[model samples]
Target: ARNAGIERATSEWIAFLDSDDYYWPEGLSTLRLVATLTGASIVCGMLSDADPGRLVPEELQVSIADQFLAVMAFRGVVPPLSMSSSAIRRDVVDTVGTFSRSHGTAEDREFWIRAAARFPVGIAFRPVAHYRIDHGHGKNDAHFASGAKLYVLRRIFREVIQNPVVEARLRSDPASDVFYRLHQSHLLCLDAAIRIRAGEMISAASTLSDAAVLCHTADELYCLIRELAYFLTFPRSDPYAATLRCSRWLVTLARETARSGDRRLTDALLVRASDAIYYTARQLRRSCGEQLAWRTVIAGLRVVPTIRSAKSFLRFLAESPRHTGHSLMYPRNQRG
Candidate 1:
């Protein structure tokens, strides 16, 4: 849809704003002054998210192609100005190419990456637009929360960052390995996130195992774990709520990591995750009745096969009612 709009544009500059979003009164004029002064093919203005008081421009910051590309590639954090607040020179669009239909939710990020690789990008720290976030859909661009962005991450990994020339350029940098690992970890964690959301535990486990065993070294694997930790956001909401959110994923990740030949890391993670889930299950039993909590207990037991879990299993067997499996044959009021 954006590409189609670009095709029909006949101006020297193209600024994109969605129907639901709007530009500040000084937005276009601010970008125009900066574009004319800096000669940047792409000019990005800050939105309300950058800083509430950062609406006035002090200076137009020019981002070097290599530095910009490296930041996006390695840091796994995108503080770049967004499309809603950016204006690109009409001619640059042809070379940077159209917004990719294949990148799913990351087309904008992917486009800026490609643009930074070739053309100069200018940043104005003034608020240029009031962009609305659709919280209900789980699309937060600031931190890359959308699992759909995995499409473009895969492409950049395969096509841009791993290209021989690109790799050679970063090889001389002292922090190259750190940068590379962080970016690599984002790919690993995001892929895991998508699979887990889709209920494809086997696939997610296999991917994590491959990363731990085949794809990464010790340092790199640690980066992967750290990135995964940030994504999970457990322990904060933790003993019960946090456990309910992140412990299951940790348990799954630990199981797979252990299978990939690292038993040492498994114990601590498994214990924490399983303990929380186990306690939550027992609590559920008090309020929701036995049958519902039984399922939670079963999940906890799957995570950690400890003596406590065994005891809980036996206790439930002796105290809980059995499932005859024929109660549905009769009406609900008449069934046992």
Candidate 2:
């Protein structure tokens, strides 16, 4: 649907909005200012679950350069920006190609990977749109219930991971080790998660053991938990529901990974799994409503009362990074 709209748009600068999401006027202005100042083919602002003047009050990092893929693959969890909060020049769009119909739920992430590789992506610290999450459940085998989300993820890896262009760009980057570590960790976790979902305990356990070895720090494991939650993508009504599911998956896999391995690694996975829940719950202070927001918080922290604080949580608001996401540099001379 978005691709069709892109085909029909007559404007040189194209922006998108979903039915449930709306752009903030100030946010659009910020994006335009960033694009104009930087001549970036793509510019993105933050997204708020509620309509807000800004997502956060603190001064946030605003990036301008061809490091979108670096940030994305390094972060290894979510996209650096939401497409709803982003605008692209027509020429860049034509060059990068439209969103993939094949990805279904993750087309935006796929598009960002391709576009960001070709152009520098500009980031402006502002809330660009009110992002209403999908919380509705599937009834009687509808709405991504029948293993469709997994299939979409598999397809995404097949296309983006196999594409030589993005892979080469990432490999050539100076920060290639961290990018590969994070990226590889996520891929391993994805395979393990799929195994856990399929009741393949032995396979899931073996994969988790390898994933633990690949993850060098608690921070990496923190991102891994978040990645699993984001990848789960179902029952989105509660932000932490995915984390809870991730925790369960980890515990189940841990039970199996424990059978044979360093007991310390097994213990580490259990600890990180619990910690991830607390961290996510603490971070999601949605402006939607106090009651609902706390529900997400309480749901997470209630399980394991140990909460660890980190400034990195603010990135969720400032970056609006979704599932692994991109760079485009638009030149002023090319525009009419």
Candidate 3:
């Protein structure tokens, strides 16, 4: 299909977009300018998740070097492309061959991996497309079960480690480091989760050991570790409050990091934090009841930002002896 689309090209430049999105008035002009300046085979802009309401760009405009390094240390920046907002040079596509249909759900991410392997990539951080998010029947509703997530993680890891082209890309370039680390931590986290879920006690221990060896404790790897630790340490009935506390705090941390211009690290941090919240909520909600769980979630969300002050926040966090009964003794970690 991509071949057919390329073969019937109507112009020297061709752009890509999914059916559910719209191009902004500035998109073409921006693409042209980026193409002229970079002489790049591909040009990309931001993607908005909300309706003129919420604009989320595909490219974050922070320091690329820091972003790449952080991702290498941990899996950060796993998602980059907004298909509707990206433009590709005709010659580049023809030279590289079209997208393969075999990749399944991660087709876009896989394409970027292949493209970055071959040519110089460029990004434009301006909002170029609007991605309608709340469409009730949209494809975004897919349930990311623990089982499915495990499969995706394994495939990503296998591809990154075993593919010769990808390995070569990693060896020579600093820019590719983010993708490598981002995928690496992802695999480790998912592998750990799978072992625990499958009741493979020895296997889970082995994977966790390997993960520790690989330096997966970076902030990006924290959420996975937090989850794995929670599941392994706490009773099924008691994890929500603790999980909620961690999730709220982690999100606040990510936001602050992004605001501070360290978004690459923050991005990875956000994913780990997000996964922690998700699994915790899913596991607890079914057994413990959402209403009861949400009260704690709401309380944690309220207090996280205040914790930035540290001094007072620490006192407050430590006031309860154990925050949310999860044994979160924050002021203890902060004593100078």
Candidate 4:
């Protein structure tokens, strides 16, 4: 229906805005100027959350490969550009084809990836739209279930793998292999997150371990660690067991990083491992008593890092009480 509407329109350029999103007053003019200046088939602009922001660059051009890498690196939480913030040349659409309805939830993202593979894309580092986050009432409502989201994400990646242009680009670039692995790891981690939410702790842990094996870079490792933290802290039965497993992984990863000569990252991992153990101890203390919590921490210190002093242990002991009973590891209100 959307494609048919675009086809029937008489305009030389087309811009898309979702029903819940709105465009800035000068959005059309800005995109038109960018398209003309860069001779690009598609032009996208920066988006504001619910407020207008200043324009920094008049126009900027980004290669399709860079865009693809960025999306993969961020695990699709951040798209290369939002559909509502983009404008397309009519001719380019005629050549590259229209959006696919078969893609389920992420049809717009699929179309953008395909278009990017075939055309030059320009970006205006200026607000052209406001992406209204609809809180719990949005498409991402928890009632939808995470498994459905995982299926949609998997389907999108399968389409990417089948795309000739994207495959050809991957073949030409050796570094693309690493990016592809990271993308795969990200998908697995996402699946694990969903499983964790569903209280499938064993399955989630298995999937997360698989993702950890595929991680080769510091960024990938760090992201995996963060996801593990979230899983441990997520509201679930036997969260203490999950925390123990996560702390073990962190210690193992820290050892690996230390051997690889990344002392800074190793130190960070060790600190997080300690935190995880301390969090577990705090939980035990609340249910049982201070003696058991101290015992748990002392036992954990033997496997991971030892606390420098009793004061530091007391500090760790003090911190987790404040954050007890929270399901989310990170702030829910923060945008991806």
TM-score for each candidate, following the candidate numbering = 0.51, 0.73, 0.56, 0.59
lDDT, residue 159, candidate 4: 69
Return the number of clashes found in candidate 2. 11
User: In candidate 1, what are the lDDT values of residues 33-144, reduced to their tens digit?
Assistant: 7787778888877665322343355554534233343335443322355778889997777775778786556577667766665566666766677654221223433224
- For model 4, residues 1-336, the per-residue Cα lDDT tens digits are 668779788988888887657888787787787877778878887776534543343444432224555444333222257778888888867866778777556677677666765665776767678755332224543223434645675667666867776777678777877767876887787676666656565566566667777876666677656644543342223335556666666566556556656665566667777777776666555544455555556556666755542444667555644455322222233213
Off by over 4 Å in 2: 51-61, 67-73, 76-79, 134-144, 167-185, 215-221, 240-242, 254-276, 279-288, 292-302, 305-336
Question: Which of 1 and 2 is the better model by TM-score?
Answer: 2
Position 215, candidate 2: lDDT? 70
Tens-place lDDT digits, model 2, residues 228-315: 5455544555556666776666666667767896575566556666666545544454444333433444444444333331222233
RMSD of each: 13.2, 11.8, 11.4, 11.0
Q: Which number leads on TM-score?
A: 2
**Candidate 4, TM-score vs. the true structure?**
0.59
**Clashes (N, CA, C under 3 Å) per candidate:** 0, 11, 1, 0
TM-score for candidate 3: 0.56
Better of 3 and 4 by TM-score: 4
Q: List, residue by residue over 48-142, the lDDT tens digit for candidate 3.
A: 54345334434534111122232222433422455677777877666555775664455555565556566664566677776543233223223
